[model samples]
Target: MIRFENVSVTYDGSARPSVRGVDFEVPEGELVLLVGPSGVGKSTVLGAVSGLVPHFTGGTLHGRVTVAGRDTRTHKPRELADVVGTVGQDPLSHFVTDTVEDELAYGMESLGLAPAVMRRRVEETLDLLGLAGLRDRPLSTLSGGQQQRVAIGSVLTPHPQVLVLDEPTSALDPAAAEEVLAVLQRLVHDLGTTVLMAEHRLERVIQYADQVVLLPGPGERPLLGTPAEVMAVSPVVPPVVDLGRLAGWSPLPLTVRDARRGAAPLRDRLTDRQPRPDHTARPPQPAPPTPGRRLFKRTKPDTTAAPPVAEVSSLAVRRDRVQALRHVDLTVTPGETIALMGRNGAGKSTLLGALVGLVEPSSGSVRTGDAIPHRTRPRDLVRRVGLVPQEPRDLLYADTVAAECVAADDDAGATPGTCRALLSDLLPAVADDTHPRDLSEGQRLTLALAVVLTARPPLLLLDEPTRGLDYAAKARLVTILRGLAAEGHAIIMATHDVELAAELAHRVVLLAEGEVIADGPATDVVVASPSFAPQVAKILAPQHWLTVSQVREALR
Candidate 1:
């Protein structure tokens, strides 16, 4: 259904092609997953299918791209709308209407479908994507994950023969991601729909792909094969595949079930050896003495003791008619890492907003250090806490990367090269002159994180920190965050990436319907919940192995 012949794309400013010698054929009714590291042109490749690359993006395309027998070179995006539906990484940019129901119906209306047919398709999409409850909600009022669902439903409602998605499940929670993937599976198997998706979270979708397209790097020829064949040689792979490689299992397992079937002997070897203690976990500190009246006696204060970085008591937040948060209580201490986890619209982001002063509590209280967050001044708040919001672009305003870094230094009173240095460490390939708007989703996220880190606040908050990051970039982030935690900085991240939580979080705080549902050590909380458990944990069930690194360490 889709064919790329000697394809290469180069933007106006670039000297070399972003992706070169990319040649592949995706059969009709099959799901093809595009896998690669950040900046390897996965999005560019997806754009070519929908004719968004050279047509709307102002790039030069070499060779031919055909979809459903129509040459994409001749067919613009609007011209191919009847047969193709595309959803990019940022869902907010994809919406033309304010409400969920309207957004879903907009595509069919544009296609000039019958009103009755449009209504029926809209309802079917809403139910398929689990967006029935949110049908009436405004796009702005919904959570990031909810917006993603609406974006997908909008494209799905048109009933196009081909769906081209970029990071389709990046913003979704575990359950929501599963629902979306299942919908795609149904489309491929029952309806004979074609899907071409590029995603950084391979663990969630690799098992479901009919074939895999591996883009090694920029200007490199692409590799096309079965999922197992590609993953065997792919640098970026899911934990289940990594575990299979470590165990020397033939034909690396793509799913948890397959890995578990071959993990009996490995489990036996780890039964006696305990996993290493979580480095993010802090030992209990000695309690301070009770206050007593020292009549006219002079005494020195204890400078060694550190107070909690953030304290929340009976915190309640309301957005529109929805009670976003309800009587939630959380405490953050220095040198601690916590993962805020739950389903989509679970009040995780709202809680982070409350901490960073972005959302005012309807009732109760939120304190960062000594000041109430909502009442504190922005200048003063920057020194106490910093937040990297779910939409990283919201934090960027400058025209170029260097300008943003310079502005970050000035705003945070940091050293001249502070932000740039951090960005270099996190992602070295981004150029100084590149526009912040032009960077990929993962690169934008890294830049935003660097901007926030320049402040070096006592407490740090991140919402969906690994949204578009590949495994290498995520590992660099883990290292940077670990160093910060070691230096007595408290980190609270609202995320749906269970693997990230397993690798970095000392504790997991699970929220549901604007209330705390589970709170404990990361291993305890994640292992207890089947939906939130990482691949390794699911494979080595009854053994409490949360990550491949832990398993590797134990075996060694």
Candidate 2:
């Protein structure tokens, strides 16, 4: 259904081609997964199929791309709307309407479908995507995952023969991600819809792909083969596949069920073992006052203890008719890392917003240090709290990475190059001269994080910080955040990355319908919930193993 022949894309003023000499074909009714590290131009290749690379993106394309026998070189995105549907990584940019139902119908209307046909498709798409309850909600009020679903529903309503998606399930919870994947499976098996997708979260979609495409890097020939064939050598793989490799399993498994079937021996090997002990530090206690201190004497400040950084008491946030959060109470002392997790639209983002003073509470209060975050001045608030929002671009406005770092330093009154130094630590491969827009999704997120950290706030909040990061990048992030936590910075992250939560978070707080339903230690919370359990935990059931690193250490 889609074909690329010797395709090469080079943006303006770039010496190297983003993607070079790529050749691949997707059968009429199969799913093809594009896998690669960050900054490898997976997006560029997907754009070529929808005729957006050279047309809308202002790039030069060398060779040919076709969808359903229509040459993309001759047809623009609008011209190929009936045959192709493209949903990008940033769903907010893809939206044209303000509400959910209208967005779903917009695509069908653009195709000049009859009113009856459009209405039928709208209802069906809403039900299929599990957006029925959110049908009337405004796009702005919805969470990141909900917006992603709406963006996908908008494209799916047109009933295009080919669907090109980038990071389709990055924002979704595991159960919701599974639901979306199941719908795609049905579309391929029952309706024969062709899907070409690029996803950083391989564990969610690897099992569903009929074939896998590996883009090793720029100027490297892309590898295309069956899922098993490609996974055997692919560097970027899901945790289950990694576990299979570690155990030398024959015919490496791609799904949890398959992994579990081959895990009998590994389970026996770990039968008497225990998971590594949790090592998250407790809050520091205040030191005793100095003895024999004269009254009103000049004294040095006590540096033994760091004060409470963030405290939310009975906080409630309401947007339009949706009560985003209700009676949410949280406290973060120094050196504690908390992971706020839940289903999509479960108030994770809302809680993050409240901490950073973006959302005004309908009731109760939020305190960062001695000041109320909602009422503090912007300049003063920067010293107390910093937030890396769900969409990283919201914090980036400069032309280049160096310029952004300079701007961040100026805004935070830090020494020159402080932000640049942080950027290098977070993402060393990104060039100093590269435009922020040119960076990949993971790179952009890291840049935003560096910008926020330049302020050195006592309380740090991150909303879906691991959205587009690969395993190596995620490992770097884990090291950075752990270092920050050890230095007495309180970190609160709102995320759907279960494995990340299991590995990095000291505690997990689960939300449901704007209410805190479960809150406890990370292992206790995740192991009890099947939807939130990591792959290793699922494969070795009742063993309480959360990560490969922990298991490796125990075996050692």
Candidate 3:
């Protein structure tokens, strides 16, 4: 059981509390989902449960937080480790060991559990999280999604009574996310474990929550109720709930099954009308006629006749003993938006690395524009392509937000304040003096994206672009990307967010075991695969409606 009584948290530099007047009780053995927009203190709220807020984060806490009858105020994080297991948004920061098996057993070792019990629990967690194959892999060598599962398994192995997770499934692929969520469900139902999770991808987890805690904004009192009750008025909601609202369905559906049950008449309404093609509504703009320096300008005569911005042929990449990519081939053209999708460790990121010259292929060839990517200089590569990696911190080095923007401008040879302007467009009102490390995961991601976009490369690569973004922020991103695509920028994003692919991608390329499994139009690829389909697509099955906006467009 968890209880928060009149809780408010204020950091050392802040004038107002990040969260205030937040009083709630989460019953034992129940899963509570914390929902809110970015910067509304969802992470701060989760930190309070594990006593990381005022204790380690150097914040002032008003009122009380108790977990399993133990007062968090009196117990530090290490003191409460026996009962509370916390995983933050960044999983790389959570690991203390080198390998997966060691990381999973580290928690129990810290707790002074019996070696036999720790070993048994570690094996169980590895199997539960689908990490058995990755047990011997180094933490650094694994993919982002794999690291997330390892982070979760580390906590679960301790057999703590309470699990406090921040964006637990943000990095995972559809099937892996389902497996992790299913394990959590089993823990909640069969073992009476308590889970308090905050995730921006509400579509993946909203249906599984036992209760919902809605944080409207900073310092605002939270709204606690059943999932349907909270989603009705909540500012952030999944597509299924949005469809229910549009159809005027009583008690908004939380899952795809519920929405599909009532979708017959809505399906009839859309029978004659076709959903608009993704990213085709905007008219194409002509190139500036400035060769090499033109950003988002289509110099090609036509779509079918356009030359490829990046070309890959028989690409093979080997990292350690694993063949990260195997004989993969692909092509990108100006104005095309492609989504690279597959399960965790499926070579999506490795392909992006090949594009940006981060990973050298073991065999075969990769060419961006006219230069071989792995052999091209960084300065030369910036003009042809830019990549915002899965970990945004890799692109940021400055002490403050303003410094990073200025550095980005200098590095890209762009006009002063260009990166800042882009950052403002993506996420408004980030302070100039705020440290890059101090910003939330979503904010950091926005800053990193701004830094990459400053160069305005003809081709852009984004890995997990919507990891921590709320719906509003993601909409802003979609608009920005749409504008770029209209101007003829070729975009390739490696992501597991199916809703995002449905909303923005013109093409979908599914990879498996470091090979391309399927490549086709976005609708054709996602609508056929049950695991990859978005909520609306699943509900409107046999109809091919991929998004709520598509349905709204058809009706209008």
Query: What would the per-residue lDDT of candidate 3 be over residues 1-556, giving only the tens digit for each residue?
Result: 9999999999988889999999999999999999999999999999999999889898799999999998988999999999999999999999999999999999889888999999899889988998898889899999999999999999999889999999999999999999999999999999999999999999999988999999999899999999999999999999999999999999789999999899999999988888875552322433312334433333442434456788999999999999999989998877789999999999999999999999999999999888898898999899789999888999889999999999999998888888988898889968999999888999999999999988888789999999999999999999888777776778999999999999998889999999999998887898999999999988988888889998887887
Local distance difference test scores for all models: 0.91, 0.87, 0.91
lDDT of 1 by residue, 150-188 (tens): 999999998899999999999999999999999999999
Scored against the true structure, residue 188 in model 1 reaches a CA lDDT of 98
Candidate 3 — worst ten consecutive residues by lDDT sum?
Answer: 280-289
Superposing all C-alpha atoms, what RMSD in Å does each candidate have to the true structure?
5.2, 4.5, 2.1
Candidate 2 regions off by >4 Å? Answer: 278-306
Residue pairs with colliding backbones in model 3 are none
Model 1 local distance difference test score: 0.91
Q: Candidate 3 — which residues are off by over 4 angstroms?
A: 280-305
| lDDT over C-alpha atoms for residue 403 of model 2 | 95
lDDT of 2 at 552: 75
* lDDT tens digits by residue: candidate 2, 414-439: 77888988888777888888999988
For all predicted structures, in order, the TM-scores are 0.96, 0.95, 0.97
